[model samples]
Target: MSSTGIEIERAAGFVKNETPQIVTSRFDVEDSHTLVGYLATGGYEGIRKALTQTPAEVHGEIRDATVLGRGGAGFPAGVKWGFMPPDVFPRYLVVNGDESEPGTYKDRLLMELDPHQLIEGCLIASYAVGLSQCFLYVRGEMALAQERIATALNEAYAAGYVGRNILGTDFSLDIILHWGAGAYVVGEETALIESLEGNRGMPRLKPPYFPAAIGLYGKPTIVNNVETLANLPWIANNGAEEYRKIGTETSPGTRMVAVSGHVKRPGVYEIINGTTTFRQLLFDEEYCGGMLEGRTLKAFVPGGGSAPWFLPDQLDLPFEASEVGPAGSMLGSGAIMVMDDTTDIPKAAHSLTRFYAHESCGKCVPCREGGTWLERILGRIIDGHGTTRDLAMLLEVGETICPGDFPHASSERLGLDAQRFPYQMTTICFVGPSAFAPIHSALTLFPEEFAERVRDVTDEELAASAVGAVPVELKGVAAQ
Candidate 1:
């Protein structure tokens, strides 16, 4: 049977995250992050283990711990690491430092505060994946992060953590830095790896397969997210079981949740695995401050931008992968976008669809063309172009491109008819379907918004720009 998802089987005393625990590497908002500071906090301990232990031992430790990628696709980190061939001569460890997921900000906080935590994580990842060379592919907009990491890398090198035959075990590595021009899809592991190889940063097909088998110039490579790598030192220093002691059986270790929208404290907070509850966040942690005084909770994007959004009634479900997937969503990047009663769910989803439309890499026709077409259709509908049948039509078309399709191909589909297709793709059910949920739910939940639209829809005069007549947001922010 397939792995459904992860849930908290038997978690004891709940750990409410009132503030960020600040582990691994700590970045001070206004203070200095010197080399001494990182070393002082027990940094580079993972690297020390890697230098002393065998690759098999390191692999077993990671596999036993159940650490998944912190990016959208929560693939097993150890499994990805084990796929690398021992005698591949040379391999690569590519770190995805791009934090373009709309609602996510955990990695940014980590990079801003403790750049070396990531560097040290990359070193351990490199050692485990059997690569002496690695690269941190950051987004172009993160100039300050680039500077901070650059300085940290130099400091690491000066201390002999990186470079030739050092750490006294003959294992040496150097991590290079690269930047993306800009694109949300670049966060995908394959796309980032492609970008590092100096391409357009579009994702490639699997099973020609995962990067751990063959990546970066047609050699074996293991691409991991910055946050995933950040936990390496902690995992090594404390044992695998210690890390496992936190999260659920399937999803172990703490997660830095980035809370945004309709919240009093709209920032990143570190919560122990399976310890924090959704209600605790709103009522206890006071991040949401209890839904804008009078308004009830509308919905929330459980993950970051690409994940599904849920209604207020479903708040009691566990936020782990198991609980989330069974409930028709995924714990994407732990970027919880809580929407209050005032927010229009459809309009919010449309706003997200627009982002996906702009950021979609044109590798496959479905994600590229389908996303664009959906945005246009949604744009017209949101701009008072609805006539009642649009909702069913939207859901239908979502299924068409979800498994994806080229002129004559698709992403991970099985056959012409969806019946032959996997249950996962056929329903158009997970996150992509969720992109439509907010809008669909809103049309029913907040009929007043649409009634106002049907009665008072009007176009203003602003046609004297280079981009022609474009749609504007509900709050009047034009879609340019």
Candidate 2:
């Protein structure tokens, strides 16, 4: 057995059968993308079964299952559906296929492999909410996924399963496929809605413009991620109780995690939420098969690029949101990026800071200014022109630009009732915090790397640099 209690011999011989294949069941199957092959695997059965029951029944079953949103936030999916206003006409449903987060590619694979499943999930969601038409906002770079889904949509419409009395029932719906212009901020639901309406992809304020109350052409709307809707069929067919047994009591069902960065085998793997630890995920041959070139683990991004990275000590923790949240991080987008000892932490932080700076929509002051300053400061550090004061400046600027509040669900099972701080959101959207997460975490987790780049500055130099309040205790800043 390896250090993590996983049998090395067993992991070495691991096959696809070792793990529960929920979302990636079709990965090994031939012709899985075609309509005929999808039907052979009992596709569209969920919507067919859903049409027999009332919309409320479908919603209740999902709520009982406790399937949280797979897109970064970890909010409960059923609760979001319930927020739609009652007796409201022209309600809309949108599938957020705009996956622009770095190191996260699970949604793109799901769409390419099982477009039929997504279409069926979309149909069930539309029925539950009385939405006559639904739109799928796919990432523009994913041309292959777009082609496959477009083909599947044509097949479903021809078979009378998509448009006009689906499966001979009164519930008729239409599904439209739209491509995005590759803006990271457009991944935000309201911003995606704004872009869908032929406008710039900038986020709208809350309260009056909440997507549940007012969205997409000023109507009630529910914007769900692609992975969230894909799970509906399994819940609809197998019942909520059965689905709950797959994962932990708090976060049930399997989720696809995309593993990237310095690893021997970097790809996507589906694991039951909270059941697998970061240690097993990294060392076990079934997953990443340990680090590349036999190097020791140094640090890793626990979630997506927007999430704070975790050190080796936190490796025993589960990959679920409930476990990672209280530990001062989140399971954002379920993308784990592993880094080895040879990596330069300061250089990496600068690279990610550049991404957020370029992706900022420039809608609000905090995000725009904060992102630009972060990029420039990190750039200076990488070029060996930074001072020790730059470290405090990074954290201070991050706090000023965005609140470091953890992402939580509206429900108790998924979030905490106790408030961390008085609700003080400075920006229009989460882009500010998203930009700051890596920069702040990099400094906190790998201080030695930052300290190495910091030059020895005289006391007079510190005052001249406008860092008069810089701590006098710091090594060279006080005096010789």
Candidate 3:
């Protein structure tokens, strides 16, 4: 494993050791984005090695490595690549670069610092999946990243590594870099595919219509994250066993973590999965070098904005999906958003809820209406007009939208049958859950902050409002 090589200064006037360098080893290297620079540092060796092996062999190695998608879902990438139907013609690969998830910027780092590495990874992925062309969908706002990738693509094509018999082999592939309209929902694989097809970005229904079987003009396709694809070259160059030995047995290899908010050193840091703790990420001299301004750590978003928040009590937990998931959150996108004690949880929840509300595509009623209501309620709470009943309503709306087992809302408490409540399978996509995770987490973890904003109301008045009872002044006025 390569070391970070640089020293990080902490807020406490101390220098922290550099972190591990796997995905980000080339980040600080001069001219790292260029083909020549990448070639000098053992670049394109993965494809050169991969070209000698068959597609099945490539897929087998990836499966053996257990490379999960780095794009928030943590789905197994090798298995996803194998989902493509056999003997299919004109299969395509789409690289999701819509890094719009709040607090997540790891993908953008790879694209900006190592475009050639991404291209080689894409080529290796295409070769493994028997693809002829790959589409790189970058966020429209990322001009520099797009420019870097475009230049690299042009260079690859000129070198005969992109089109028409790549590297003197019968295999041929083309890469197209497309920009998005800056929609967060487009980060979804199906929504991204829809946008790539010139349609409004909206997620497609699953089952018989999954992307692997039907994607990109209705042909077999495989969609992968930029970081996920970048790892292919590493696994291709070094065997899976060596790669698997670095991190935890289940989630192997190093992952790029984008640490932001209240950190002494807020930037991208690469760490072996399941090997580092959130506490070390926040306080250890080698990582973030402790919190900013000597502020005590209150809570943190373990994954991206969509993932649930974690209290300081969970600080010792490893930064891995398996551990975080069992602890009531996930390692979504590996985005660590640290919040200091002085931060206002309710107000922060309101801001994030409003973002999701504004970004809702309105294709699904649950997400559209639910996100709007969540933001509005949180806004009212933040504005100092919330009621105790509003807290119950917040949990209810989140449950109705996402259909999860909300621990606060027991079936017996509502006097309703468990089977009758829509608490297990709710929305059309994961957006509903994403929109509510932070809200539910805020309400669950920081009840005192929310309670401080709650307005006092009589039981009679609250019950009257619950049943939509009209005010005495407005009741007769409406009729008149």
lDDT of each: 0.67, 0.81, 0.81
Worst 10-residue lDDT window for candidate 1 reads: 406-415
Segments of candidate 2 deviating more than 4 angstroms: 1-17, 208-210, 403-424, 459-480
The TM-score leader among the candidates is 3
Q: What's the C-alpha lDDT at position 248 in model 2? A: 92
Cα RMSD (Å) per model? 10.2, 6.8, 5.8
What lDDT does model 3 reach?
A: 0.81
Worst 10 residues of 3 by lDDT: 413-422
- Of candidates 2 and 1, the better by lDDT: 2
Over 4 Å off in model 3, which ranges? 1-20, 407-425, 459-480
Cα misplacement distance, residue 223 of candidate 3 (Å): 0.4
lDDT of 2 by residue, 1-480 (tens): 447432333322113536777677776677988999999998988998988899989888888888889887878888888888899979999899999787897899889989998999899888887886899999988999999999999999999889997888888888999999779999988999999998999998876635988998899888989999999988899999999999898888988888777777777888878789988888898788888765888788877888766777678889776667766667879888888888888888777888888899999888899989998988988898888878888878888876555332122322323222112458887787777777876776667789988987767776755765645556576676
What's the lDDT for candidate 2? Answer: 0.81
Query: Given candidate 1, what's the lDDT at residue 259?
Result: 70
TM agreement with the true structure for every prediction: 0.81, 0.89, 0.90
